[model samples]
Target chain A: MSSLEELAQRVAEGDLEAFGGIYESLLDPLYRYFYWNLSSREEAEDLTEEAFLRCLLHIGRFDARKASFRSWAFRIAHNLLVDHIRRGKGLRKEELDANREADEPPLGETVEEEAEKRALRQALEELPSSQRQVLVMKYFSGMSNAEVARALGKSEGAVNALRHRALRKLGTILESRGWR
Target chain B: MSGRKSKEIKAALAEDLLRRVESPKAPQRLQVYGLQRILARAAYETRTVERRWFRNPALWRRAVVLPLTALLLLAAGTSGVYAASMDAPPGSALYGCKIFFERARVALTVSRSSDARLEMEFCERRLRELQGLPESGEYRAWERWSREYRRNLEGVDSLLDALPAEESAGLAARFQAQLEEHHALMEGLLKITPAPYLPYLQQASRECMERLQRLRHRHGMEEEERGQPRGPREEEGTTPVGDTGSEVQDGAEESGPCFPSPSYPQAELEDLAPYGEDTAPSGMAWTSDAEDNWGSSPKESNGVMGEGSGHEGKGSANHYWK
Candidate 1:
């Protein structure tokens, strides 16, 4: 919400009430971003908290003109994700399987549709982490190229090129699996 | 790939798939509650720090040190007993006065977690001081220092026990690691300690190590984390001597006469600012200049204490000091 920008200003002034408003707006998208990447609900939640805390502490450093509060917030979450991966704290395979089952389509899907969706999910998962992140932000989270670029610290042009390449690869994987 | 048919189909499919992938909403109660807790904690820490500063005796002393020195000397008939005891070594009469002063300090500290960590830091300094002591003669000094070491070790164990198991895990692991480092150094010192005083040093180290081993076991931490050996006796020649002094190197050198190193590093502090500026929105630029501790009132038994409480409150203080 546009109120997030105003909330950021208040948060910079040490208003925890304003921080609560910002948290409500961003928690879901940020949690979803991490969940899509890490495939672990608990870890995503933990990382979400860590990112928000860092944001609350360093809110003064944020310049709204440089990036939207959403993008700035995502940058914090992205850095945390990088650190988590660097530390080799990824989930085990069994945990991944359990999470995947829960993540399956909940209702009214034909078996064929669910299978196709699973195949597409696998294809996306097979992409490199950076590309996967771009796709998740662009597709699932619905962030625009400029926004994803800001969040990922890449140029807008770079994000567009990455998106094009990622979409081609996904198409290739779908065709290969005969899921198209 | 850019053909009209392919483009249309790809766009439609991408839209459908992305839309269909369900993104679960964050759990409202847990998510909101967690943020509330963090916000409440940050606000609470900011308030305590401000209160501590207003009520801080050391701050008051600095405001009129020269005038107070003259007035105290005129009134007390003897040099200020508490101020003079600041430099007392472990066994001296002044040292008891020093502990009494610390009782007030520990009482005023807002965070129980911080107090536990401070006690651990003291145990480390006492161990390093014990190692630095002469091997021959001065048995009285050695005994006194060893007694203080045991007392501080007890403080660490008891304070750690008082904290919730989850909250104390990181500090406890770090304390265990540093204790093992000293345990290694004590092994080296055992051969050289005066034969008469050797048993006292041995007993002090044994009790300290046994307590540390139990702490580690209780937390399910591995001894090999700091390269300490498992079970009671550490293998000779295995423990690294570097770590013993390494943990003691926070800006202790600059603290000079009065201030000792802080109990923990900025990173070890859970509820407070990292080091420099308060988390308060006072409109000051945030700088990473954590070269010194927060400059809180120095720990009571300074000067004669070990190297100093380095900025790395936990073993990670290894970063700034090393």
Candidate 2:
């Protein structure tokens, strides 16, 4: 059996040691996923907790044949994040604005050196959720295009097109900001 | 710089930009604390499921039996018996029996009291009826009843046991324990109440009532077939007692006083009725209009609103080169 299947079985059997192992393995990645999407340290922490709480609630319904455990768990986290945004409970508008400003290049030489980085982060925040998600999985998580397509339940070509469009928009934004 | 040299310069800038973005980390305490909370939540859910199974004698029977037996019983047409029995004249003994069975089921499944109590009177009445059953099958029924009764009680006990021993009196914590205990006792009494067994003894005592009724409609006599004490069996496919018409009406009325109705401020609700939606703001923005506009028009509105923004800058150049 695959490692995920074994972990799931142990979980079903109520083996906390195995569960702790799974937690250790996936917690950092899941935390990073939330942090990238939320872009706030505090909200990312809360959303990550909420995601794992949901995972605990519905773990019994997971099916290994349909998706790997990581994909399924991540999908739950993604849906929870969407729900959290819908509920208007996570990172306030003010915080998002502040983060965007913080990401900009500083006023002097440091500003010039980091101007592109700041521009990229700002551009990423402004993209639609669909494009943002594709960019996040592909670029931030180092997922391959095919893996991203699978995770997002989109066609590979659709993901590629989204990636391409996201890149073009980022470049345009940077150009407008005189980063290029 | 030459065109190629400028292109190389842009690529390096993008690479440097992308590399500078940092991934945030959750506090170490939050990670450990969240994991503990998750484990606790999982344990609570498991206990809830176990409590529900033990509280429901019918479900308990099903859980104990092989899956094939359940499928065969379902296919054999005994499912309709519960439904037909439930339709017996209101206030009649059989009807009362149906109501008690339903209450036990609801007491296990639902957390709402206004919902739980609607059928509770019928259950209490049926409990009266069970006390009148002859002593012949009394022992067998009591044994069957005790096993489940004890199991459910123990399940509740285990849940309380698992809780940190120090939180014995906080309202939220105490309320859950009380609810579990109340439900367990009600379920236990429903099983051994001894009243509904009268119908069973009546069937058994009157040998001439029909060897024919017994044979032709054997599926209808499920408790007899299993040599289980006769009591109210749920009518198969019948609306659960909680969903009965009168119960719904009562629920609508009781809903106003028992809990704060979502329709608080009746005038506001009526005013919102014309909108063909619940008036209460669920706190979510109506995003359909925005989504529709976004989907149809791919133009850059301003800033980086488009699908791919900023990627074509230094980062895109670097990625392309790499």
lDDT (CA) per prediction: 0.64, 0.49
User: fnat, candidate 1?
Assistant: 0.28
* DockQ of candidate 2 (2 decimals): 0.16
**Local accuracy of candidate 2 as per-residue lDDT tens digits, B146-204:** 23323333333333334443432232233333333333333333333233221122222
CAPRI accuracy category, model 1: incorrect
Every model's DockQ: 0.17, 0.16
Residues A69-142 of candidate 2 have per-residue lDDT tens digits of 77777777778788877887654657776875664333454554455444566666777888877776766665
Error of 1 at A103 (Å): 6.3
lDDT of 1 by residue, A63-175 (tens): 98889988999999999999998888654456677877876454677787667656766777777788889988877666889889999999999998887767766666666
Cα RMSD, each candidate = 31.1, 38.2
Model 1: how far residue B225 lies from native, Å: 75
What CAPRI grade goes to candidate 2? incorrect
